[model samples]
Target: MCGFIGFLSNTNINSENKNNLTNMSSIINHRGPDECGEYIDDNIILCFRRLSIIALDSGKQPFSYDNNNYKLIFNGEIYNYIELREQIIKDKNITFSTDAEGEVILAYYKHYGKSFVSKLRGMFSFVIWDKINNKIIGARDPFGIKPFYYSESSRGLYFGSELKSFTKNKEIYKKEINSKSLHDYLTFQFVPEHNTMFENIKLLKPGHILEKKINQKTKFEAYWTCKFDPILKPQAEKIKDIKKALEESVKLHMRSDVPVGCFLSGGIDSTIITALSAKINPNIKTFTIGFKDEGYSEIELAKKTAENLGVENINITISPEEYMEAVPKVIWHLDGPVADPSVIPIYYICKEARKHVTVMLSGEGSDELFGGYNIYREPNSLKLFKHLPTPLCKILKYISTIFPEGMKGKSFLERGTTPIEKRYLGNAKIFKDHEKKPYLKSYNKNYTYDLVTKPLYDKCKNYNDVTKMQYIDINTWLKGDILVKSDRMSMANSLELRVPFLDKEVFKVASTLTLDEKINEKTTKYLLRESFKDILPEDTVSRKKLGYPVPIRKWLKKEMYDWALNIIKNSKADEYINKEKVIELLNKHKNGKIDYSRKLWVLITFIIWYEKFIEEV
Candidate 1:
């Protein structure tokens, strides 16, 4: 596990570019503080920072063969390397140079060619240079567990594990903000994966590969697509399969040369992981963080859950000031604006866990994979809208506006009357189009969220409404938001975080579960809860998602109201947003006339991100 940077250029690799490459790699040194390596040539340069997880003695990266005929730079762990290498030795009569995973990747690619990625089962973002073919190829994992960003310039193609790496060479890489992305960011609170907030640099989509040669257009294609063809089966059969798959996944994810532990939140996601992990390795350690008894903190629950599972639990309580102090650095580590307040404690927990362990197991993808979000139940609550005619639905939407704000079914009447895409853009809905009109100077009706979600919705046309929501989120909310912050926060602490819930085999079992199994009248993650009911605490099976709930709304009203007002008053946001309007909203919240805390937080984060990335201040 590490961070890497490389560029393929038509011009010579001069001393200036070499210096920039080294600086870029060093800035992300926290990602892999153990060791470093480099490979420089006339037309290309590959720099790597090593964290030394799997084969600590011989895992130095930029792994090459045939005297540099094929060089590699990778940023994630390949869990199936042992199996792949054994097969290559049997079928291709090839002998590996070391026990490290890179050689297995090289050998498998040599035999399978471009299709090699589809055969692997792990979280990875790897780039290989085929010197003989005069081509360089890069691929991100199926679930985007690792990150890959690149910029196309006249010089050539530059890529790296973090956006800051590309920013190191500003002579070639530009840092202008993408306004449409900012507009979308206000609604979603994070930029979409395919489009970064920066104009030139973009995230390579998960499950896809980009291949390019000198004087050739980059050819990009998806090596795999996670499909949901829910198979109807007995409840008992589905529960058994899910149980078997999760246990197997946890076993595979424990493949590490270093000590491994787990992060335990109050939510069942992490509780389930800790239970399964303790069964396999009873000595495993777990970590948690929370606040005082503010009705939202989860530390007490995490403690009880940890004791029930019989693992050493480390719990930390963060004061409001400590949480406030960590914001700037957290945003810096994040590489972009992510308004998810939960990241603060997540970052701190990873930092604390790093002192005791090198690798930590996390429960990130379970919610998205199993339809665990409470918002997913909207379709069931709004079933009446499906029976209404389209014209009548539109008329009802107009009439619903006349209803008071707290009136029953006001939101239901408004959302139920509209199409899914128009109403739902994943779980977040911060600012509506008309609301954003007061903020931005211009809006592109054509380039609205449909540019992102329509394609995904069209692909899953035959799925049930709940399944369709899960599909959209698995691609957008899961990849763009959840995994992005998860990677950045964990890596920021120089700790390797693995998600067994995101394993390919686990996803297969989850995909086979019908909507009823995922969410029913009583609870979310119904099948998952049933599968672990015998193992986990009975109350845990029905617990709501109380993981890391920071009191942002209260903070804005009391603790940070003055600080927030000054930020807006002093911000360059006036160029894009109406300061008077923003001030009005902030005042309304402070005076208890409204609850625009989320919108305010999103705006403040954007300002902070813009200043850090674009303004160079």
Candidate 2:
């Protein structure tokens, strides 16, 4: 619901540092244009920008508690604050001065110490400065629905909700690209771990707590882990539990003081969210976006669902030119490169929804949480690997290399022979290990995507293939890509986007679903469909997942060919990227020799980001 930036310094604060803090906070004003608050002490500064979701008049932050001994600057919603407040008042006999959620957080921290985070639920990233103990405690939400970035410099530690905020105070921090992260970005289209595109700055992993005291080493630890534990239960009973949990989550998520709306799409995830939300509030508004290109737009399907639910549907059809124009701004808001074409539609939809509603509910975590991706079905198709001997599969993999690239069944053979740990790298696989050698000038043969995935895969070794993939995504893809775009795009428009599907209660239900309940031979999210069949339209229950189908592949070939080529020719990333090779790929796509849209887009976004953050700065 907001954005925050601050620093914990090793020395006393000065006027220069105060000015820098103001500038740093000013840069992210779009995140919270409603109000601004600041708290400064000898060694720490906390600046907050409010979006005014719940406690409109009384929620101004840098909330001081315990006789002004503790200071808290928070950047998310505590959906259960009302319940927590009641418990605190009864147990400690406390009198609150305001209805702000930040007060509830401070009281809980006083009572529970470091363990307070586990007792709460909702998406959040916050920092609390204990003036009494000269200590700092920071934590990100369980699913990373919000962002928290920090850097440890000689001056001190600087933290913020967006990476761009650090750029405003160059005196305290230096801007240098992290080469290892860039190398990984080429393969995964994102920095898969805690390390970010910048060298010193790092993203705090989800469900993790960071503690730092003055004149001591900073420590980080995980307070929660997303592990799946399926229980043996009847299908009908499980379905009933799922419906109840999701309904409760949605109802809680709609606890905004302002008008709340839902993002609708042709897919079932958004439809189900809208359907459930409409039942709670009959006059809810839904937003959708699509393209003019055939087989890409879902406007009609979304409209049909909205009509069926008796809600007003506001929609737009983006032209290729409009989509191209928004690319640079989208990349800037993202704070780094994310090659997901779906981000464009999300950006536009958030902009549109903000016009009517201050808070929007999205369906981002459903795919990762409930095994909704089509690739999850790959394990079932590759069952032959389990039947055949390892040596024979290796031989088949070798034989597959003899066939030409893109030959029928070639990728299947290659993947079937390879281990799941090596073959699967979350949802987006832009450049493979061998493919990056030609495109990256600083490519290290030893550095590969495995550096990020191997440890995660090792943790889930006991899981089935389908469950392993889900675990990997819930750890990497869900946080790195899906939530990044959702947070940045929504905040860029000053809109508070909430995910009912990513709630703690809903995740507990999803973790217990069997593979048969999640995916069958014919469809994904099987249990979800079965649970909501009577409420949703039949086509919606059975519709395949086509999440924001962007026609970037077609645009790169025709409409945006010259625009993309211009960026490739003039890009200043030659020290890191091989421009000639990228141009060749772009030429091949335009000439219809290959469909290199996804790969080309990855390079284009990074180039634009480089220009914005590196060259322009």
Candidate 3:
């Protein structure tokens, strides 16, 4: 709904700092073009841009409370604000001046202190300057649906909704590539944990809160974490609970003053969201995007789903040329490299949806929360290994190495023998440790994917393999890749994208699902499909998850071959990457020797991002 940038310092405010803040705000103006506001003082400055979702005229922020003693700048929607507002009025006996959620947040903070964040139920990243206490309190939503980035330097601490906002004020924060993040990005297709591609700047982990007293070091604490506690209940009862939770979440998420729409796909997740939304507003519109490529496009299926729900479907088919042309702009908006090919379609879809509506509901967190990924079925497929002795499995793993590359059953043996902690690294595994040594000029052997996953694995050691995998994704994949593209792509067009599936209420129901309920021998998200079987079309409910498929593999083989080769040739990343190795992979792909699309895409995305932020800057 909005974007904000600001800083806290011990030095007095100057005209140059004010100018820097203005420039920072201008860079992200697309996030909120409706209005802008600022709050400045001797040691702190807050600048905000508004899209005016809930309160239209009343929600202009830098909303203050308690005789202007506490000032707040927020970037997201508090779907439960109306309910929280009533609670605050009754508890504190305070009269509110505006309908803005930010004011309610301030009043809540005044009454309950930092503990107030726990009571909030929405996607948000906010900073509250407690002028009275002379300290600042900042928190990111539990699921990280909204972004918050910060850096510490001699000039002080700077924080904002996007990484680019900090680039404008170079004197306050210098830009340099973080080698560790780059190395890990090669493996995960995203920079994991708190570190970003840029040095000093770090993403505030979801469910975490930050507190900083003037001139004191910032302190962080986890306010919440995603953990699964499966309750053994009857299948019918669990299905009913899931249905109730999702409907309630959809209802809460639909609260907005502006028109709201839903993103539709042939897949069950989006189709379910659109189906539920259409029931609430019969005139609801749905948006979909696909490619001209034969197998890559889901337009027809989405159209059928939309027609079944009796809603108008707005769809677009992107060409190779259109996708190629949008690459630079997409990477720029992402603020860093995210090699997920799906980002392209999301960008185009958000651009198309913004033409008709200011707010759109999406189904992003469903896969992670409800175990919708195909890979979640891996443990079931590899059940044979569970029956084998550990020593025998080790022997099989050794024998697997003897088989040639691309040999049938070679990967199966290797994966079955390995422990889940070592084998599974969320959904995207672009490069292996040894593979990176050949591609990365400055590869650190210690900078393996385990550096990111091990700590997460340790936390959920008691969980089942399926739950552990979900936990890893809920922390790494969901926040790093999925939610990053969701926030950046939607904000790129000034459209407010809400994810009802990621709601705390919906997650509570998902967390209680048993492994058999989430996945079985035949399908994933078993309970989810069962709950919506009657409401959705049969094919829509039973369809396998294709995700937002892009024709990157096919495109790399033909239309975009030369374009990709040219980027590799002219890239300024030679100091960090092995150009010859990357070129070899590209050439091999073009010759149809192998499908290196994902690896090439990861490298190409980093190159484009490097040129934009490093060279151009």
Candidate 4:
């Protein structure tokens, strides 16, 4: 609902530097366009852009608490602020103030110190200047629904809701690209958490707090995580629990000062959200996007569902030129590369939805919570493969690798025989371990995606195979691509996007579902579908989750091939990429020898991103 930028430094606050803090606010104006506020003092300066969702007159930031001893600048909603404020007033004798949500953060932190973050129930990223302690403390939400970026330099520590804010600092802007992240990007399709494209900048991990004392090293510590300890219950009982949880979550998420809409994709996740939301508020507006490619479009399905629910549906068709032009603009808002092609459609959908509503409810995190991805079913078939002797399986893996590329059953043999940690990275596997070698100027096997996923796996070691894969995705893919894209794209249009499925209450129920409840031998999210089978359209409850599909594969082979070739032809990424080898991959796809659409999409996105940030800047 807002964006904030803050600077902590021993450097004197000069007039020019103060002007730059205002400039930083201008750069992220799209995130919050209603009002602007700035706070400056001896050793620190803070800036804020407000969207004015709640307490329009009283909710302005950089607010000082305890009579100027502590100042706060926060970006997000604290849904339980009323409850927190009442508790603080009753138990701690803290009294009377504006009804702003972020005030609870200051009140709680005053009494509980770092542990105060554990008591929050909303999406947030906040910075508080503890002037008395001569340090700063910041925290992100439990599931990373909000974003926080920070960098340390000789000037000071610069932190903001976006990475583009760092561009205001000369030193932070001059750092070299993080090649390790580039290689990992090609593999996982997004820069993983903790690291960004710039070597010096990093994301504040979800459910963690960062503490910076005057001249001491900064430290980060986690406060929450997803756990999969199934409470083996009857299928009927689990289904009822999921229904009650989702209903409660959807009701809580509907708390908004402005009119809220839903992005209906015709998939179970969005369909479920739309159905539940319509039941509460019948006049809710719904939006959907479709491509020219009929195979990839779901406008008809979404419209049909909208008709059944008797809610007004607004649908738009994305033209090729509009999609092409929005690519660079979308990358600009993303702050870093997210190679997921679906970001394109999300950008358009949010842009259109912003025209009619200020807030929208979306469907994300349901897949990771309850088994939703089709790939999670792989472990079911691989169970027998895991029963084979290790020596024979290793021999079979070697033999399978020798078969020609695209051979049937080759990928199955390789994945089934190998361990989950080695085989499953996330929902996507763009450039294989071998495929990445010839394409990058620098490659390190140590820079593998496992560096990002393995720790998550270790945390969920007690989980079943399907749950382990879900954990990896909830940590990596969901945070990096799904949530990031959803947040950035929606904020780019100055519209707040809320996820009913990602609520902590919903996750609590989902975490307790057994694998059999999450998935069966044939379908994913079986329990979730059956829980609302009667309410959802008969077609939607049984439909596959294709997401908001973008036909980049077909476009690259047809209409956009020349456009993509030209980008690779006159390239500036030679220092980071092997030009000839990338061209070979592009040529093979053009000649129909291989389906290199995803591989080329990864390259094209990164190249455009590199040009916009590295070259154009």
**Mind giving the per-residue lDDT tens digits that candidate 3 earns over 462-516?**
9999999999999899999999999999999999999999999899999999998
Estimate every model's Cα lDDT from 0 to 1: 0.85, 0.90, 0.91, 0.86
lDDT (tens digit, per residue) of candidate 2 on 1-617:
99999888888888988999999999999989999999999999999998999999888888899889999999998888899999989999989989999999999998889899997889999999999899899999999999999988667788899988988877744657788898889888888758888888888989999998876767999999998998999999999999999999999999988999999996899998999999899999999999999999999999999999899999998999889899989999999788889999999999999999999998889998899999999999998788998789889989888978778889899889888998899988888888889888888888888889999999999999999999989888888899999999999999999999998989999999989988889999999889999999888988999988899888898899999999989999888889999999998888876678999999999999998888877
Q: Is candidate 2 or 4 superior in TM-score?
A: 2
Residue 387, candidate 4: C-alpha displacement in angstroms: 3.0
Give me the runs in candidate 3 sitting further than 4 Å from their true place.
Answer: none
Q: Which 10 consecutive positions of candidate 4 have the poorest summed lDDT? A: 166-175
Model 4 stretches with alpha carbons more than 4 Å out: none
Runs of candidate 2 with Cα error greater than 4 angstroms are: none
TM-score of each: 0.97, 0.99, 0.99, 0.97
What CA root-mean-square deviation does each model show from the true structure?
1.6, 1.1, 1.1, 1.7
User: What's the C-alpha lDDT at position 477 in model 3?
Assistant: 93
**Model 4, range 1-617, lDDT digits (tens) per residue?**
89998878767678877877777778999988998888887778889988878777788888778888888888888776777889999998877678877677887888899898888877889999898998899999988999999888777788899988777766568647887889889989999888999889989999999998776678899898778778878888888889998897888778877889999988999999999999999999999999988798999999999998889999999977788889889998898888888898999999999999998999999999989999998888889886788899989899888979888888888888898888889998898766888888888777777777777888888877899899989888988889899999999999999998887778889988888888888789989999999999898888988898888877877778788888887889888877788778788887875688899888888888888787777
Q: Cα lDDT for residue 189, model 1? A: 82
What would the C-alpha RMSD of candidate 1 be, to one decimal place?
1.6
lDDT of 3 at 406: 71
Between candidates 3 and 4, which one is better according to lDDT?
A: 3
Q: By TM-score, how accurate is candidate 4?
A: 0.97
Q: CA lDDT of 288 in candidate 1? A: 90
